[model samples]
Target chain A: MEHEEAKKTTFWANIGNFFKKIGSKISEKAAKKAGSSNKTQMLEWKKDGWKATVCLAPALIILAVFTFYPILNTFLVSFFPDYNYVTDEFGSFGFDSYALVLQDATFWRAMGNTALMVIVSVPLSILIALIITVLLNSIKKLQGFFQIIFFLPYVTNGIAFGLVFATIFSPMDYGLVNTLLNAVGISSVGWTGTTNIPYWAGLFVITVYAIWNGLAFKILVFLSGIQGIDKQYYQAAQVDATPRWRVFTKITVPLLSPMILYITITSMMGAFKSYSSVVSLFGESMGNGQNETFITAVGYIYKYFNRVVHDNISWVLSRASAAAVILFLFILAITGIQMWANKKKVHY
Target chain B: MEKELYFASDEQAKKYERIRKVRLFFVYFFLTICALFTLIPFYWMLATSFKTAEEVQRIPATFIPLQPTFQNYINVFSGENAILLRYIGNTVLVGILTTIFEVIITILASFAFSRLEFKGRDVIFALLLTTMMVPGEMMIMTNFTTIARLGWLDTYQALVIPFVASVFYIFFLRQNFKQIPDELYYAAKVDGNSDFKYLWKVMLPIARPSIITITILAMIGSWNAYLWPRSVCVEADMKLVTDGLMYLFQNEVGGTSDHQIMAATTVVSLPLLIAFACFKKHIMRGVARSGIKG
Candidate 1:
């Protein structure tokens, strides 16, 4: 079967295999000046080039059609404020879309919300995860057992769990967190209340969810990093009767700095693209009767893209594309800066 | 002097031993609390999933279900709630098909990049690497236009096609493929094996673990996918699990319908949780490898 299928190589592959066979069947005697001609031959027709073409064609084509083309197309569409989605036409291009998007209060609020999610959630998660990782790394008994317990959230659906957080944080008498709050003599704070949900309340719940949801991966990364640190460093610290805080700071943290920075960067990046996490918490409206208080930039773009306005979808798409480009550039700049900082600051 | 530095006397050694025990106790105590933080949500999810509807909304909510029942699960699979069941089925079908095709395509591309002597292979690989840097969310708008042009909206292809060719998986599989010895390829050629045969028979066996990781990750990606599917496949039958979850909230379970929502989420989360438990080592190793690499 394999042989038959190999014989049945695609048209391009057959062309490549044909060239390969011809090239090989030529005796060295016939091409004694092989080294001189080799450059041209190699450039024009590499051995098994057909196979590579065949193997790579699907990915390249799919990526071209879906990813690469869309990038260029998005850039174009972002500029063409009147580009039509349904009709596949555009009026002469301008900066109308950027002008519109830049002026929108919702778009700016979405940006603010995304920034908040990143700034608030990323650092807190990193700190809490760092502490848990230290504890998890120090233990001897049931380490695997505890790890599996902690990793439970990693495999579960983020949407499901975000809703679970929503349900848990529901500011009702029966809500679990509310019940706990009542036990401490505080009343409900309207965290997920259906009407008049406070922006701060929504932000707090989202931050807590982000920290909880983001911890598993960060812990796993840090724990692995901690284990990779040479045991000799700790032994040396012990020999000197180094204080525990000193050991953690001078020896362990120095080595773990790279991983720390790594997790922070990834967490930030993940937070930047966050949509489902926020939507799952605040539902479709993102905040009922509160004017989209929890909506992120992606959610803003998503809202415009699926806004279902009939006559001006072109305007809608252009706005979304503009927002997307802004998002892309922000991510590129942030990642680039973080990477630069990571290199300069971390020893590893 | 070393002994004196470590412990001044017998009493000092005993005191240090006692301190060590106390410290260990505190460390375990701390870890247990953090672990409970992760577990309590799942506990609430499962416990509520089994509770009778009346018990779920009682003031000062019940920590444990007084009468555990499967009626909510039955409802999820029955009546108007059956749409949730259809969404789960759609997610599974889409996930499986996408993984199979993705694995095959990744293998072919990786094998080509790894072993096949091709013109512009280095340049193409570099192009792929750069493509990974572009955030995917930016492409959603134009890609939606393209898919609409292709008339694929409200279809399974809309959900599956955009995801099937991940450059990250291609790069990951290529790294594993490059690790194979050159002698193996030369020997396979001398033994008259074709490229496809060699990939199927030799390189694949060596790269199985990485391939399995890609497969698991792909399935998880599909299972958790929302943003694209939410925009494109908004039809009732075409929704993936995550999208349908919100649909469940909006169309089926209301704001106060906590028990039914718990039931739906539990059904969605169980297969994945069980799979991870059974394959914990493989999963963690895969995650660790990705996290450690640049």
Candidate 2:
């Protein structure tokens, strides 16, 4: 506990020192600009700082325990291959945990499934959203009604909805999806087959539900975005008799590109972290035992190391942390790349 | 020339009106179909909850139940396996506690960030923003360990404590608090109010909508939380409402209880649906704000 406390203080001090250096420079500039009052400002700040600390204490303590310490400790634990998590002991530090994760085929499959979900779902959802938003933009009647209908799923429980989707595609002849397919002269297909769910079938089911869930938010964004666009743009198109398709392609698409980009990044990140959707569609095993085909990277962590299994949890826990760290870094790089590309974006 | 111009312009206007009506008809057509895509499943979930087992199994699935009954709902609540209320109680307890604690901490932290002149506040806030980039996956494994070590597993604290301090809410609430105008703080001081007193009496009331938004989001988050609770609160009794569905899934006999399962899902889903119906504006804006903020 003392060691943990020491590390926590040092982390805080580093944060303090890093800012204090730059803060001093900025304050010095202000001091020169506002000479006499700057002294009083300093005195006032001295009084305010302690009060701020007192107010911030409860939050700071909770954040340190739950957020900060865990991030640092997880990274540290990943490197300590021989780390006995239960006893909190480690003989030496190594990368064996990472090696184990990289060598495992399940991890690779998890990554593959995750990549496929992101690649397929994000762009499709965005394109479909943009199309709907544009179409909704052209009309005035029931647009609010449509927005509310689509947005319903956004607040509802995802697991419950995933189960709903599971039933819709329940593979039974009486299932809604299968029944519809039969009406269209197609044979019944089991999208979420219990005994023998095909990999592609499972992936297809997950992506469909994901895309459907995604529409609510994307449509909300574009509908709201369309309202903010100056009416003059549409008026200009109207006066020029610009083709509807051309106006949609030119004005609407370009105007909503930033939101599209943000949604793309967030959707991909959300897809990467997906766990329940897969669990909801397939059973808890993600698939039948050896045929377990649908585990995303996050689900992989959840599946193997969800509990502290006494047998090999020490070694396996490190591996789970290693897998999580890789996922963390990949997501970090994704956010960093997007932020660097859009330098003004302050948060994801 | 004037007569010719009028005739041609009139013809063009008629053509435009014809095209406009066609497009509008298609718009309504497509939008209705899309709306039904979402609304149908919800309708099905609700409709199925009232379905009898035989009605559910009939060769042609009933669109609306002909033999609608409360038996499925009763079945969900009555059997020894009916932990639906227990799980819902657990979820509500956890959600209320987490939301209250998180909101208080957020108000305090946001107050400091927005109103006070703390030395490292900017950098600390900046650091918090960067934490947003760090995937939540990183926290789960280690948090699992931390909670395990503390023997908090299967406990409400395991569910509530880890999630109580949120950087996003602090940032969100601070933005609203900053708009409260610094002059109020000065005026409060002149009136002999302490900083905390000023915040409590002045700042919070003004930031009420933002507070409500954060509160709804936090509650919804707790209500929908599956993975975290599934990990930490593994015991059957401590499971969340979402888990109640999972429990129904695992213990389902012959998987033929689609009607009862749907009933369970409907009950599991009702609180949020009702909450949304009540606070639609705050919920929608909160979602929009979460996306748009930084």
Model 1's DockQ score: 0.46
TM-score for each model: 0.91, 0.91
What lDDT is reached at residue A222 by model 1? Answer: 88
Position A133, candidate 2: lDDT:
86
User: Which segments of candidate 1 are over 4 A away from where they belong?
Assistant: A1-45, A308-312, B1-9, B251-254
Off by over 4 Å in 2: A1-39, A307-312, A343-348, B1-8, B251-254
Candidate 2 lDDT over residue span B1-294, tens digit each: 112223248778687568768978988998888888889879888887798888776655668889789988887789754898899999999999999999998999999988898687777886885565566778887788788889998999999998898877887788788788888888999999988899889998898888888888889889988878887777778999887677668434115677888888888888888998898888888777655653
* Reference-based lDDT, residue B74, model 1: 94
| Candidate 1 residue-wise lDDT, A16-39, digit = tens | 343454456455425656546567
Q: B-chain TM-score, every candidate? A: 0.92, 0.91
Residue range B97-212, candidate 1, lDDT tens digits: 99998988888888888888765666677666666666776788788878878989899888888878877778778878888999998899899988889999998889888888
lDDT of 2: 0.77
The 10 consecutive residues of candidate 2 chain A with the worst lDDT sum are A1-10
Fnat across every predicted model, in order = 0.58, 0.55
